[model samples]
Target: MSSKAKLKAPVAAKKPVELIKHADVRVDPYFWLKERDSEEVLKYLQEENAYNEQMTEHTKVLQENLFQEMKGRIKEDDSSVPYKKNGYWYITRYEVGKNYPIYSRKKETLVTAEEIMFDCNVEAKGFEYFKMAGISVSPDNKLVAYGIDTVSRRNYTIRIKNLETGEIYPETIENTTGGCTWASDSKTLFYTRKDEETLRSDTVFRHQLGTPSTTDVEIYKEEDDTFNVFVYKTKSEKYIVIGSMSTLTSEYRILEADNPKGDFRVFQERIRGVEYGIAHYDTRFFILTNIDGATNFKLMETPEAHTESSYWKDLIPHREDTLIEDVDIFKEYLVISERNNGLNKINIKRWDGTEDYYLPFDNETYTAYVSTNPEFDTTILRYSYNSLITPNSVIDFDMKTKQKEVKKEQEVLDPNFSKDNYHSERVWATAKDGTKIPISLVYRKDLQRDGTNPLLQYGYGSYGSTIDPYFSSVRLSLLDRGFIYAIAHIRGSEYLGREWYEQGKLLQKMNTFTDFIDCSKYLIAEKYTSNQHLYAMGGSAGGLLMGAVMNMAPELYNGVVAAVPFVDVVTTMLDESIPLTTGEYDEWGNPNESEYYFYMKQYSPYDQVKPQQYPNILITTGYHDSQVQYWEPAKWVAKLRELKTDTNLLLFHTNMDAGHGGASGRFDALKEVAEEYAFLLDLEGIKG
Candidate 1:
């Protein structure tokens, strides 16, 4: 028998489950796959995994070569630019050959002896999958609290360590969001806990050092399932704030850091469709909000004594073209990160009204953002800058003198790699609605804009999250092999401003899919690539994009990759038990509502799958994913396998021991990337 015939695809049993809602009866044949722990489900997943292995067996050598090439470009013995916080110069460095970071701090001076805090390499020794997050140091600099997740499901266990004594305490807080805020007293901390079933961060608790987590006091509980709660200390270190936020509205409660046992007071009441963020500075709180129909957002401020919306006065009035993305408060200046004309800008304004200017940037398609500036009393404002061709550089700019220093630039160790060898540009593609969508592209300078060149287009146009054009060393594997990379700034993203995002969500969500299709057509029409040489990629919600585009315009691409894709929109949205469903109603709309139900069914990838010749495709998912459940893609692949007419490649990979983000090890994550790159390259007949 032929090798392809010997390795047959896994056929999932069709156990029809009728989902009735709003007078709509949708019959789901592979709904039984959601029963995660069932023996049948595990067996099917294993069979599919086995089949994927057999189908890709020919490319194992290429995958390994790609991994090594990518790994070689990274500087393994690297340390991040240390930023001072609370009298300590904190630094995170990685040792050569180590898979995790080593956190340490210096006393007062950068040259002082390094005091190692937590060596994640040592902490992650035995676990198959491990992740550590939210390492918070106490005000006194003696105690530290961090969260650890061994299961890869995102629910972390809070652990305390004595930095002075180098001893780990026995107390453990379970099922938390892996973040905590310290009170003035080093003995006390406030943290947010997640619900066991839905994994929603809905409750905040105050815990005392050396006490059992069971004795931790429940400070507040969010009764609304559609909102999530988090606890954090303001940059001013004056208040411990509890923030409750939904998609469209937010409310905050604050208590003085010195008053750990005192009752918290509400900062502001939540109003529907109003979203605001608070940044504390001295006796005043700066607010960034969409109040009074500031669609692109505006900045306001209120006295510390009067914490209400009525007390808010405009510090920077609403501008039609600018979206106030964020504000970083310092002792003498307010740094504003905003987006205008699809470009990122950092505006520095002096409190005394002496000077106000934006940091100059000349790149056509680049990303620049405020980096870590923990100290409130500094003239230097640190930020990072990068582009499709430029390596990432961390810079510190003096707000007073306007002088800048490049602290460090990413070191791509590949001897053949050079930024000058690549060219980057931004081009606009006309969408179906006559809207101009920007597409950022980078290719080797030697590349010709001919139809023979291969091109890979990527996008993530949901949740107003703008996927900026940034540098990547791993991408060299594709570019060096004669491939052009492009990022389509579709409407769902806030690339052009808040209005761009508004037009791409809710009932108008089809614009996102159609916008991507238009971008692909533009690239083809421009002769940068032909439909036979074009490929597409996206993960998470972008993975949803991949699925939708596959159904809408499969003929436009030669291959596609969907990583942990959210394909079963109608079913996942209707089930509130899912981790992030309830909180995302403002994003994908509530499918329980008849209008949204019918609207989602019209474009929902799984529901819209039809018998057609699909391009070569690969779908990746994690067994322990807390975000998009593994079954969405599993059932999606099952349905596609049953209905697809062509015998083109259809591969499904499940990271058995990982979750939404995939493998925890630094090198291990690269292996997944290497596999993805290999798949794309193999389809193009490229071999090392």
Candidate 2:
């Protein structure tokens, strides 16, 4: 990159605005940036982008090289492992030069002729950003209903097409959630619609083929702003289920798939703090829920006729250390996905209790989860496995024979790529509260323990989402460049169990930030990397983590990257109009209350910006991001530029054509990764 030292940062004009909530007064100088599409906001964003471009001009070739290096590792002409569903084998493949996937299917046998359902490359020709979701084929396999989003804002337009005639129906449904569930007759489908303003999926609609979407009947509407509703057909293909859920509770309604025009009856009323998920198996429904204070969740089964909690009987009791994640029911076997301590475990049990066993996985830090097993009568169960140093492998295990076959393993095409060249391990860091936080690390075998090597730490602790140690081809660029990569499995995520997540959210949110800081300190103390060479990165909620960490311990890192970050916590939570605000109150406490307002104000990234020296920071956001609005990062950068004492590089880049995810194309997205890596590498004066 150019001598960033010579470049001047863009100055965003101050337009102070006072926001009062819960008797608290706050002055925001750059709140004007939140005015979407306004001339002033547009100009300021453009100027910042221009500044970012100029500052990193010298890294143009390096960026391209990194992009190509990462792209080279991917098998360009590759097809996913075909899985059978509803008498057809569905396959998703990509051409050598195409940036999109081509969806196709075959008849009962693999030798049958292939029928191309959707070639996204052709559909994406005119749009800078395009996404296709919810490709649901009719029960008879004659018609397909899908949702298309050209603007990348998560709002889709649903359309239907006849597979045999290759003609699209005239009806187009707008503002949908991009997935539809087909009924037995193949003429009726159920889809969820989003509220135009808040973008919340709040209503489910039933659409009849050959009819206008305007005339479609509303099946159900979620009255609570905190909840969202979705419709889906069970794997058993007998029931169409409508699920309404929030951060803490869930409710479901079911109707026979054969009775498309029938009224759906509630299976179980939603109770506060009681979350449950149902799976159909012949005469019973298997539920995974945290009922009766089972915080880690348990598996229960009840007759299809008696689908209330009162009739529910425990099939697999909850254990304090193990969290039952999900279940897949088969005719002869029952599969349970669980997490114990910090690792994923898959347990298989026979229906008659003849055989019960857990799939054995031997790795210090790896991820394993059930893949597609849509057919209920099949004895084979498919699951995926991968680790920091291992490529993903799709394995199929026969429940009856107790045997497994490797269906397909992800191919890393880079000639120099070899799993043996890298080493991965799990280590624990002690937190301030005497909690042990797990850190997963991967590095070259010839690494030195002397703190001179550059290190990049990554973390995202929010929403009870577990960030497992999965392999990434793009990450190889950093490892090859003499950098040590670490993933901090801190609090706010269900890495250990549900309790781990509970201890890190709401009032206990500070634990997430402190756990990360403690992990950094442990790495430095162990001589893995010094403070001068240490760096951090995260995106979205993790981006929130990056913001909080830099404010809490800026001196511990040489640089940081926050992507589509949710930094304005207090201001966002106070406004229920924002897309995710209402739904996330249970995750991040509602700021309307004085208790939460004061607590959130303490750590909200934008609120905590002060006149302090910070590490070189890079912030990225998308203009059309409906989840984490683009203005969060824009206002944050403006505030940091005004308050930070050091002249360290602080760059912001906004993708004009994309949403929370920067770019739509596979190769195009790598360019963003290249830009991020180039920024970190350029700071260390490392160039190829």
Candidate 3:
């Protein structure tokens, strides 16, 4: 044969090595369903507990080591300083200095090192229960009301704290409650609570301050499962409005202050769509809704002839492509925060429809929150803005004068902590079917992009959740250690809008798994990391994403961490007795339907795990997790162990006391993070 034709006949084209199909690598259906039974499930759960005990001890050690190393560098600084009427900022740092005062923005130099305002200590303890919850401040800023978990654990109690007196009044209530509104007199506070025992219904209750044992009377009650009740007071304090959610829509009922606890009649119902948010202006209720099929929304005003079926006037027409994130009614103006092009912008419009103004900022991320101020004409606008390389900076802006002053710039780390040390970049990847997805990455800039660096990819693509850019302290540990941290803004999230969410959920759930795989492939192709050093982590719905990705591309990751994952889709969906299963049908699709059942079974991680080479997986859940039951993860790990062909490590950990979130307090929270980080480090071959 000639030298050019020396290529041997492709070795008989290697008869396609009997590729195993998904159906070919299946498990016994009876073993998963009727045969194994609850007792077997319990046995698996016990195994999970045994594994968790070891992980917990290891995590404690890791945390102690980290704390010891960082103790010397941890500087004491004043935090959450409050502004006084005298225009002085009161601040307190228990570890460094005592209570102290600084000049206000109006009097102090913008760049001065000294003369800061309000010397108040950061109340870390009070934040344990309200870490991820909302807080309501009184109109006069004298009292603050926050929700705290009651003895029932599932239930929450609204507690009002006297800011000046340092006193707390906790009121007992049911589960799922928010929107605490203070009466014009400030003596009574109104809030909503869901009575899950009564078919998971919602009820509104009014509580008086300073009363601990007094049984609060329920003002209104709704039977529909979807009806969520919220209480809000008008800007003029003339009326208190109660809003209710129905199966396909929502309605609002208004009652005068004199009869706040009486049966409120519906003043507006289904004026536009099923979801409506009401904000009170000068004796008028401004309703925000998408009544005319416009995704963006319009502001409708309730005319004096307000009734259940009354038509509303289109006060603010729907602005194309602009969604109003939040709206606050100040004295003579309406401050609206609109999100456009992934950035928050504030627009102030005169109540009389005269003048409007837009404040410009260079950053892409900004949040403006209205601060309680006594002055009607002027409102204290507190905002924080940051970018990829910039640390957070808090500012106070005066609406009338358009005067902006930096209230507190987050203390940047020492010169040793250089932004150049860490690099953040955005990249796009093509999915299996040619869908392009965006992914954000953070890693050590000095690290070689030669597929040797350990990479941890995270994603949460569900529930209209937007995983936006924010600050994280623990991420610093990974960046400093030359580990690449990447977040895939996958489809199930509202990052790209509602359409993105619609495309990634239900029968199209496979899109999420495929998208994650694409991100991993892109990283490998770009020489960011090799499959041997890649790890994936997620929690809640994100946890489901982790499990699916691991099943779909086990060869692409060395290890996977799934916390409170909803893995057992078939089992969980079949059990309607669970707390959230019924309400989640709209998002996950009812598996009882034959079409949905078949489609879901296809991608359900717990059901899809086959006898194949699998990556090391560490699954964590909470025994008290009402959202995603502990059994889901337990069953998933047990089934995987029985079915997986490879002898890879599969560990399951369950928090016995905590709920969906594993920890409650600061130390506990830090410990959870430490454990997660340690697991990733171990997989990535990193040493403390």
| Model 3 C-alpha lDDT per residue in residues 296-331, reported as the tens digit of each score | 656778754464335677877877667666677778
Q: Please, what is the TM-score per model?
A: 0.99, 0.99, 0.79
Q: What tens-digit string does per-residue lDDT give for candidate 1 at 1-688? A: 2777677899999999998998889899999999988999999999999999999999999999999999999999999999999889999999999999999999999999999999999999999999999999999999999999999899999999999999999999999999999999998999999999999999999999999999999999999999999999999999999999998899999899999999999999999999999989889998999999999999999999999999999999999999999999988899999999999999999999999999999987899999999999999999999999888999999999999999999999988888999999999999988999999999999998889899999999999999999999999999999999999999899999999999889899999999999999999999999989999999999999999999999999999999999999999998999999999999989987889999999889999999999999999999999999999999999999999999899999999999999999899999999999999999999988
Q: What's the lDDT for residue 186 in model 1?
A: 90
Compose the digit string of candidate 2's lDDT tens values, residues 379-418: 9999999999999999999989989999999999888999
lDDT (C-alpha, whole model) for all candidates:
0.95, 0.95, 0.65
User: How close to the true structure is residue 472 of candidate 3, measured as C-alpha lDDT?
Assistant: 55
lDDT of 2 at 334: 93
The whole-model C-alpha lDDT of candidate 2 against the native structure comes to 0.95
lDDT score for candidate 1 against the true structure: 0.95
Better of 2 and 3 by lDDT: 2
